[model samples]
Target: MVTYTGDVTPGGAPDVRDAGGLRITKVAVDEKMSNNCYLLRCRTSGAQVLVDAAAEPDTLLPLIGEAGLTTVVTTHQHWDHHRALKAVVDATGAEVAAGFPDADAITEQTGVEVTRPVRQGDVVRVGEVSLEVITIAGHTPGSIALLYDDPEGHPHLFTGDSLFPGGVGNTFGDEAAFIQLIDEVETKVFQRLPDETWFYPGHGGDSTLGAERPHLAEWRARGW
Candidate 1:
């Protein structure tokens, strides 16, 4: 697992590292909301994918550099998460992708057409690297996560606002939504993935499945 115990705040430098065969760069775009924007590049082909255009276009655009953005993925239709979507897409002309149910909302908020409506079992290609789309609805009607299985090592999960460090995402006090989120997370993520799998959440610091698995019961009991 790639351990990064650094400052993840807006205006703070990005945390860049090599995991498996890909280059992963994580930056916090919106400081108050702690929204994390990730850039995943396929080392072999240099094809890049920008995940969640959170905020701070000035900071996010510069990070793209010369690699060229191939695609921009919106984890959900949350306004905070897509605050910089228009700017990034306008700069890179990248294809916009989002969950099927949230496509219309994303398009409305960002003013960029959602070219791809991703769903579970769909594979998003970034050069030769492939990311499997996992729909985990709870935080929103169309919340989704991307899973990249590193052939050389553990898998990498970009879990938007679905799963977090101490607990699952806030369900806005809705018990049914909370139940759905927990069920999907436990069934689709925790139970299916290995302990070493690294989950990069939409906000806050990164954590591994192993580190979080033991606290699943506690999280469920507390019912956040």
Candidate 2:
């Protein structure tokens, strides 16, 4: 069993986590941007889902291999986050999905149609694995976080540029937006999930809710 470090570097190697039924592959891309892209593959049915084709199809497509991708989920409308989305979808013909509010912008930017304009409570399936949609607005109007509760273990969260290790995502200097992002992150994410829930961010490494819960007040005071 390979260790899941979650410390991926651009052009290095993906960090793989084999958690019973699901295999999580986290790769770094977009060069200077240092964006993170994840592949969630189900062992039983062999269905796969790509989270944020942020960049470098050469790097991403190979990771996908012959099994082919079932879906490509764009986290938000951020240009940096969807750079390779078109290429991946073109090569795999995978269905595209994103937050309903940001779906249009993602399409306009990437020119790839968002077939599934998902919202809160919606579930995305990777074969038999289920990922619940959690809209964590503020970083972007349509920013979303995907939650996967491991039936046998702890919960896993895919927070695309929303929650991070130290603080929440940047709100571009809008305190109200910062408040909204943090509040949603608090209510929908922090308050709801247990301390052990592990989260994967859009960029950088991963962290657990327990590691980050203590700094919520500090993050709020600083107003990111």
Candidate 3:
């Protein structure tokens, strides 16, 4: 069984590592063009998940180790998120998983080799915890969010560049697609979830589903 060590706000950068029945860590990396990168881990099994591996591999690796990471997960294909993937993969033997659309880019950029291509509806498990994948394709063709049920608390969301604290993730590829993705988030992920769900966004501070739900209509009214 996993225990909660509460939320620790480590000094230096915007990195956070939370340990529940499973572990969830985020390391701030300079997005080549966007924002920060987040690294998540499952403490009990040492299974690691990287939302974006952009930051310095040397600095980031130690933090991952501090959290007892074992694998990596990419949130999108932006250069910032995956720039140091090859180095990290080499060191940890950690298989990288990304959305289906970014598979080609992930393959072309970091040839270290990917273990598998994860898509919507896929569940990545570690020990007794399982992260459910929900594809939100607007910021990038293959942008995916990982959702998990906190065995000890409310459900949590690792929203990679999809939903943020105040607004939403950046849209770089398709405008219509992004708009559609926003709608999908509303009906499928957002509305369907209980109000108590806590969202761990790729950027900015965390927010609760209850607090943010009211703003969805506002985002839609403004054209999303």
Candidate 4:
């Protein structure tokens, strides 16, 4: 079964689980906002990457353990998502990466330089594991998702805040932004990936594309 732990506060622990051969850990650093930080480790070479340095560096650093962090990727430039980015980067000395358009905002907010500017189709390597970048706009112009294909299992996607379980992320009531988000999610994500592909979002519990696929029309009709 998939493992899930409570939000990481002063004394809370993180959720740890194994997906196929990759080791995945999630910590809810910002409980009020339910912001999530994920750590993905390659079982073979022990290389690891942190997806979204949400918040609470003291809580997140310990969970990283001895494997060390190879990279820290900010999925978007949202403040809540990168609150602890500078702290984590300072402690781990890991390379900071983010989408091209959002990189400047992230750097300005976190005070940590984004050394790598990733775009759609770019590949990020962590030991033996390879994560492909998929740019999804609307939620944020440079919002991006990472797709990791486990040769022996289904693919896993780390979608920042662009795609969620119930529907596409909130577009701040912008009709055009909402439409753009849905269109990008449907064409770039649902249509291209298999239904079994699992997604670890920026917050809350995880979800599979299959569980969310049937409701595409519903989400679109509601215009959220």
Q: Estimate each model's TM-score.
A: 0.96, 0.98, 0.83, 0.94
- For model 1, residues 44-137, the per-residue Cα lDDT tens digits are 9999999999898899888898887999999999899999999998899999889999999999887889999998999988888999999999
lDDT of 3 by residue, 1-224 (tens): 44432232323454444647665655455433434556555666666666667657876778776544455788887776777888877777777788888888877877745577888899877655788888887778888888887777788887877887666776655568668878878876787788888777655567778888888878766654
| Each prediction's number of clashing residue pairs | 0, 0, 6, 0
Model 3: which residue pairs collide? 2-21, 25-39, 32-80, 48-70, 48-71, 50-73
Candidate 3 Cα errors over 4 Å, as ranges = 1-19, 31-35, 66-69, 172-174
Q: Against the hidden true structure, what lDDT does model 4 obtain?
A: 0.87
Deviation of model 1 at 211, angstroms: 0.9
Query: Which TM-score value belongs to model 3?
Result: 0.83
Task: Give the better candidate number (1 or 3) by lDDT.
Answer: 1
lDDT of 3 at 52: 68
For candidate 1, the lDDT comes to 0.90
The superposed Cα distance between candidate 4 and the true structure at residue 163, in angstroms, equals 1.0
Candidate 4: 10-residue stretch with minimal lDDT: 2-11
Quantify all predictions' global Cα lDDT against the true fold: 0.90, 0.94, 0.70, 0.87
lDDT of 4 by residue, 1-224 (tens): 64453234423567787766688877777558878788989888888899998888888788787778989999999999998888888888899889999999988988899999999999988888889999998999889999988788889899999988899998999999999999999999999999899888887778899999999999999999
For candidate 1, the 10 contiguous residues with the lowest summed lDDT are: 1-10
Rank order (by TM-score, best first): 2, 1, 4, 3
